[model samples]
Target chain A: MILVTLLIGVLVLVLVIMAMGPLESLGWWSDKGAEKAAATIERLREEHARSDLRTSYSRYVVYLSGIGAIDGESRPPEEEPFVAAIRDGVPSACLVTDVFPYSVSNHGLTAQRPMSWLWRRIEQARFKNPEAMLAMLVNLRNAIQLFVSADRRYGPTYNIGTAQQVLESLLRHGYRLGSGVPVTLVGWSGGAQISLGAAWYLGLTKIPLELISIGGMMSDDYGLDRLQHVYHLRGTKDPFEKLGWVMFAGRWPIAVGSPWSRAVKENRITIYDIGPMQHNVKDHYFDPTAIAPDGRSYLQVTSDAVVALLNGTEVQVIPT
Target chain B: MGDFLGSLWRAILGVWGLDSSMAEWFRDYPHSLEISITIAMLAGVSTLLGNSVVLFLNRIRGWRFALSLVFNGVSMVALFVVQAVVIALIGFLFTGDRLTFFQAARAVMLATAPLLFGFLELAPYLGPGIARVLQVWSLLALWTVVTVVYAVGYWEALLITGIGWAVMQGLSWALARPLSALGNTIWRALSGSPTLLTAQDLLSGHQFMPVEFDFDVSAVEGGERS
Candidate 1:
């Protein structure tokens, strides 16, 4: 009886958390003005102008990290090699890795939150004890925001906010808008949904937008039509990506009219099997030590796949 | 205040057919104020949360909109009373139970307990699905009340509630024009808005415009910080 009561309490709390993102986006809690967004962009442009990399990069790659992330700058040490490989592969491409995908305001979990201390401790604990229950709170919280991005009612508002932040990051990294320079969004896990969510708003700037989902769990509803193409990199052993297929009705076979289905039919979404990598932990996609049967590490193989996509090279494709 | 809250809690549980004793209290006492308050709360919460029916209330902006919500809630009680009369008539025809108007009204009002969580209708993606679930739950509650309180046959209760709902829907469709006009008038009177914004307009997030940025970067490359 106590267990049942606890389960009910947890369910109610989850619902409340899920409702909060949309309510915030809808300007129920507090309205975040457009002026702040404009100011941010302006500041980024000025900063970019002073940088040495200005006008040097040919293509722009914005990397949106998964739910485990607390802020824009901080990343798990295990994931760093995957990022390093991308930078090595595409030396000319400006890789912007500081856009936090979870918050509609682009504020980190520890940024001005009432539960900042808890989140900060959770972030620290994630490194020391990755298996701790408290560490999973970050994932749980962000996973809800991922649903918010998929939600039609809230997606536009949340996506616009994220897109603005992405735009600021792009500007900060010397991405000249309307230069017709292709902007590729590389998202890992839940960040894939955020990438897709922001695609519509980013597309508005007329920069050629592309998405590369690295074992991403995403719904089909978030304006797939706006992206030039979607390159999904999945591991043969990963079951988490399949969760997206089951959770969202729009991804189902019967939802033939959905953007994702249409994108598949139109041959816009390209799927690649990046060896036998798991979703996260124990031989995950970015695990350097997890060597594939083909004599390549999971990180190396995944990086090669992403590089191939960026370079528009032929790869082993999975037919829909 | 404690007594009121306790009764309200019992009323909520009773509507879900959980507490028979509470259902008996509602059937016996049939407090109009309590029923009205329940309906008012349902309407107020739904409006405040920006449910599709009263999504325009979101556009009002500021705490003064609380007055508009109160107006919407009180008006819903009047509407519920009218609906209860129709339900009572249908019940009499189907079950041959000559229940008093107040008894029938109280039963119908109490059955709306499921809708007290109408704020859940604002939840993204699941909102519409949740609304449908709540509607079905309320219908089942109505059937339960007729069976337990009115002592009507289960089949008769189903027929009465189902046909009563169908008739009400048909009436609503037939009187759509006048009903819409009346709704608009009431909305305007309360909100001071000429027209209520549709759910599409409200939920589309068009009110929050995307910030525009200068796309021209050639000046920056040429050492000019424009």
Candidate 2:
């Protein structure tokens, strides 16, 4: 009975947390009022103007890191090489990696929040004791934002905020207006949902937008109608992506009227098998030591697939 | 204040039909003001936090909207009283018991305790499902009140509430056109809008249009800021 009560308490807490993101977006529990939020964007614009890299690039590649990320600037050691590979592969495109996908205001977990100390401790624990359970809190917090982005009722508000952040980041990285340069979003894991969420608002800017999901778990409800194309790079060994397919009704074959289904019917989504890579385990998608049967590292294979998609080249699919 | 909150918490548990002792506490101390406050909270929370309710609220402008809100809440309470009287009449017919209208009213008001959390109906994706669950929970609570509190047999109580519900539904169906017209008239008089925007219209209108952003390359130098 005690266990059952505890379980119920936890469930209620989770539901409360789930409701909070949308409520905050709706200005219910917002500490940062509309003026402040707008001011933040204005600050970004001013910073962009002051930046040395003001020259227009032909294309912009925005990297939205996975749920494990603490902030915009910090990248996990394991993931850094993969990002570096993408930079090397697509040197012509300006890569913007400082837009934190989990935050509506682009505020990081450690960024002056009420619970900043807790998050800081968790971030430290990830390095101090790599196997510490405290590190999972980062994933738990961000995973909730992913759901908020997928919710139809709340997605518009949350997505619009993230999209604004993405736009600001693009401008900061020298993306000239009306340059007609195609913007590619390289989203890893839960970042894929944020990318898709932001796609509709980004599309309004008249910039051609494409998505590259690297082992991303996404729901089908986010407006897929606006995206130019979706390249889902999945691994045969990864079961996490399949969880998305099973969990979301929109991803189901029966939901023919859903945006995901319509997009699939239109052949707007391309699925590529990027060899025997796991989702986020030791030999995950970005693990440089994880070698496939063809002798290329998982990082190299994933990066090459992303580069191919960015360059408008057909990516080779590895057979199961 | 602590005592009041404690009692309210117990009242919530009682309405879930979870604790018989809590149900007894509610029966012994049937505070009219407390029950009325609970009902008002239900209406106010639903108005403030419910997504669909917010859409309707958005249509209304100025201080009259608050007056209209209070009017609607009072009407809801009166409606519940009328429903209780109808249920009491039905119970009298089913069990030949002299269940007073006030007794039934109290029971009905207490049953609505579960719906105080109706604000949660604003939650995306799971909102509809949660609403249905709360409805079922309230039904069970009402049934428990009829049986355990009123001392009516379980089957007889079920028959009474069930028939009463059917009768109410029939009345609603019969009065749908007239009630809707009356509601619209009152809303128009209170709010400036003749009709509220449909959910689709509201949602579509709420889409993010980047009107502030400069799309032209030449206008980038003096881009519009919010």
Predicted structure with the largest DockQ when compared to the true one:
1
lDDT by residue (tens digit), candidate 2, B79-137: 57667888888877877777777778777777777776666666655665676787667
For model 2, residues A103-209, the per-residue Cα lDDT tens digits are 88888989988899998888788767755788788888888788778877667667878888898888766776555788999999999999999887676556788
After superposition, the stretches of candidate 1 with alpha carbons farther than 4 Å from their true spots are: A28-30, A34-55, A316-320, B1-11, B17-26, B29-59, B185-194, B197-226
Report the lDDT tens digits of candidate 1 across residue range A1-320: 89988997887677666666465555621344344545555654565456453366789999999988898877666778889889988888889998999877778888898788998998888779766688788888788788778887677667778888898788767777646788999999999999999887676556799999999988895458878899999988789987888878888999989989999999999888767777887888888887766677777788888988888786542222
Candidate whose TM-score is highest? 1
- The complex in candidate 2 yields a DockQ of 0.19
Could you give the C-alpha RMSD of every candidate to the true structure, in order shown?
A: 6.3, 6.7
Name the runs in model 2 displaced over 4 angstroms: A28-56, A127-131, A236-239, A316-318, B1-11, B17-79, B89-98, B116-128, B147-226
**DockQ, all models:** 0.25, 0.19
Each model: TM-score of chain B? Answer: 0.70, 0.74
Candidate 1 TM-score over all chains jointly:
0.84
With a 3 Å backbone cut-off (N, CA, C), the pairs that clash in candidate 2 are none
Clashing pairs in model 1?
none
Model 1, range B1-226, lDDT digits (tens) per residue? Answer: 7877776766776666545566656666646447636664663465346353233313444553565455455445555676688778887786677878767777777777777666676666676677677778877887777776557667877888888777766665566566556656766675455544232222211111111232333332343222
